[model samples]
Target chain A: MKSETVSTLLVEAASLLAIGMVFVFLFLALLIAAINLIAAFCRKFPGNFPAESSSVPLTKPLATPSRKIDDTTLAVIGAAVHQYRKQHQSNVKD
Target chain B: MDKFDVLWQSTALAHFTLGQMAMMLVGLLLLYLAIVKKFEPLLLLPIGFGALLTNIPLAGFSQAGGILFYIYEVGIDTGVFPLLIFMGVGAMTDFGALIANPRMLLLGAAAQFGIFATLFGAIALNWVPGFSFSLQDASAIAIIGGADGPTAIFLASKLAPELLGAIAVAAYSYMALVPIIQPPIMKALTTPEERKIEMEQLREVSQREKIIFPIAVLLLTILFLPAATPLVGMFCLGNLMRECGVVERLNKTAQNELINIVTIFLGLAVGSKLSADKFLTVETLGILALGAIAFGIGTATGVLMAKLMSRVSSRKINPLIGAAGVSAVPMAARVVNKVGLEANPHNFLLMHAMGPNVAGVLGSAVAAGVLLALVG
Candidate 1:
């Protein structure tokens, strides 16, 4: 009875292995297909999706100025430049 | 004199057996390995300590009425602990890389060849004298090849609880040894040129894709292999908690406190099974040997699969990432990264290897489900 059981188990194991390999392959193939389909749909309907704000733009395009900088904006820019020079000079000294 | 005799009788010295003494030493060795070598210290340390506690005479810690027994019966026997651990693993896992390039799932699936192949190897061991393994036993033993600790423990608990101690030890030990074991096979199979091939950067996977991924996978698994639902279902629950923004508290608890608490109990329960009669046998040796062969085979097949895929695919794929298909998670991926860097100084394969690494986890769970459906 024991030997018969072992023989049966051995046969079962071989079959299970073959079945397992095929099952894994088929399941993963389906997953791959699903992912591709989703990706294609996303690409085709890009406007419906949110833009990626987290990524920094590699190069900013220069757009024509809509309006001239006012005196207040110039004053703020001057103050910012002064602060940057002050920090840069201090770091240079250090 | 009666009082003295009573006190003496209560001492472990009065009841110590050679088996208990030997098991105690084994426990100490595990402790040393965990603490000094830092080989899976979090789990191993508790396991080692539990071993020490169980082996002490007069404690009866592993007996039916004992605390360890209750923990084992409630958790390990019913297969709750490993499922809880899976939930935590899922919560911690990030599937962004896997979603970006779904082809990595092939490597994951291929790595499971180790598990199924080891089934035959376990049964083949019956040809040796004084060795006999039933089909259920072989199924439990073969899962060590999956290189997944919780899945191995869960499957072993269900199929062959008697072998749980040896199989768990083998599974975790092999996982820890991924750094040592994977590199040589990775190097032997690939040329320097193949090893140095730089993969293109993975595209950014959207938050929406990430959110839908666990649900989609869970639904697919339930439809095709409902047997896998226990492990995969809990895993998807954890992943959903992580991906969905609303359950931050639940996610943190699953990943941190809940898993930690269950890990302690799980380790103790596994260690309780390390008594000499169970652990010190010819079968233990067979299991260890089969586990090594299984892990080795899995690693080789994963690399081979990648090599085959690289030829068919349009883009270049560094075959080292295929070694991560063994499901040792970040460790296997890290090994691939380290190996890739050695071959080319500028190469970074960490993000790319993660694709196959996470896929290996899901693949192993599916394989476990298959085994359970067949043999359980």
Candidate 2:
């Protein structure tokens, strides 16, 4: 209500601003240290991380497997088998 | 003659005041900004429409028995809606960038200079005969610098409900203007070389560390600043649900459905505050001016802090990312990235800027806590 109170409040605000900034920096600094520590620990004990088997396992992930036969190739293979079977049946019938 | 009299009485013309008409026009302007300009449309659209509804004379939309009134009573008045939104934000946020480069927290802290600086600015306006801002009023007004709408609304609801309309409007307006407000100051503070600097790529954070991060932050908050528990607590809850990878359902609800519902109610509640009597004051104009100044000062301080850090710290930080420390989330980060690209085509500062962007959220939350503890 008084001018004195108003001035006191402003003074308090200034102090709090300074204190708040320091706390923010300090709190985050601690978090930074914690993060760095965790990173170092993870690097040191990589085995503690989930094994490939425990997580997603891609077998021969980088390896290129032999190309599978195309539809045309499969059709050709089927036609040859059918022709051979038909000729053998004809011979038996003769 | 009696029938004509009843019709005239029923019409808006019979009940409208100059202030109400002006507020209605303002509401339409906000709608135009949201729909056509795509400025924070999710919020401004509803807020604008709510303003329109509230300004209608015969419709008791903002009165005791009205839907908007109940929404305000249950949510904004009790400060629940903002907390729910914070939780959603926490769920949606990825703190990995922040965790990987925790030092960006200093930029976040530096950006809050706008808040404290504007406190003095708001109080000093008392010298102008028509304006007088108490400490509580000043605290509520200054948080517009935080650039987080929910935090501003939360603090205003707690400290100064009367100014909620102007404060919320100013906060969101400045947040939407981040693309325009931050760049020139960011450019002025740093050399072209500093803007062009490329930061190192962040390390991959572990799932374990990600899961633990929110819990650790909550523990720290409880130990030091319990007043912030309402905001930080809900935020951490959302973040933990997201990171834990166990509560997919709860996380989905928090970040998406739950948040969407709360946003609608929150917008309308805020709009209800934009009544003709409340928003038509000289103080509202002062708030708008102070809000812009706060954002500019915040942008300037963040860049300066980065420049200071660059000299002392061994690691190189592109000062452009410092502007993202104002906590407008991905928008501020994108602005930094755009500015960085202009200086050096090869530099992509989005991910780097994100570190400070999220840290700014935490920093502002902490700053709000300090203000609440001291002033509220």
Candidate 2 has a DockQ of 0.21
Query: Which regions of candidate 2 are displaced past 4 Å?
Result: A1-9, A40-94
* Residue pairs in collision within model 1: none
- Model 2 chain A scores worst on lDDT over the 10 consecutive residues at A49-58
- Per model, kept true contacts as a fraction are 0.36, 0.24
Instruction: Write down the TM-score of model 2's second chain.
Output: 0.99
User: Compared with the true structure, what per-residue lDDT tens digits does model 2 show for residues B1-376?
Assistant: 9999999999999999898899999899989999999999989988998899888897888999988889999999999999999999999999889878888888998898888888888877766768878889998999999999999999999999999999988888888899898889999999988888998899887776677788878888898888888989999999988887767778889999999999999999999989989999999999999999989988999998999998899998888888889899889999999999999999999999999899889888988998898888
Error of model 2, residue B155, in angstroms: 0.9
- Model 2, B28: alpha-carbon shift in Å? 0.3
Please, what's the RMSD in Å of model 2?
A: 5.9
Which ranges of candidate 1 are over 4 A from the true structure? A1-5, A44-94, B1-4
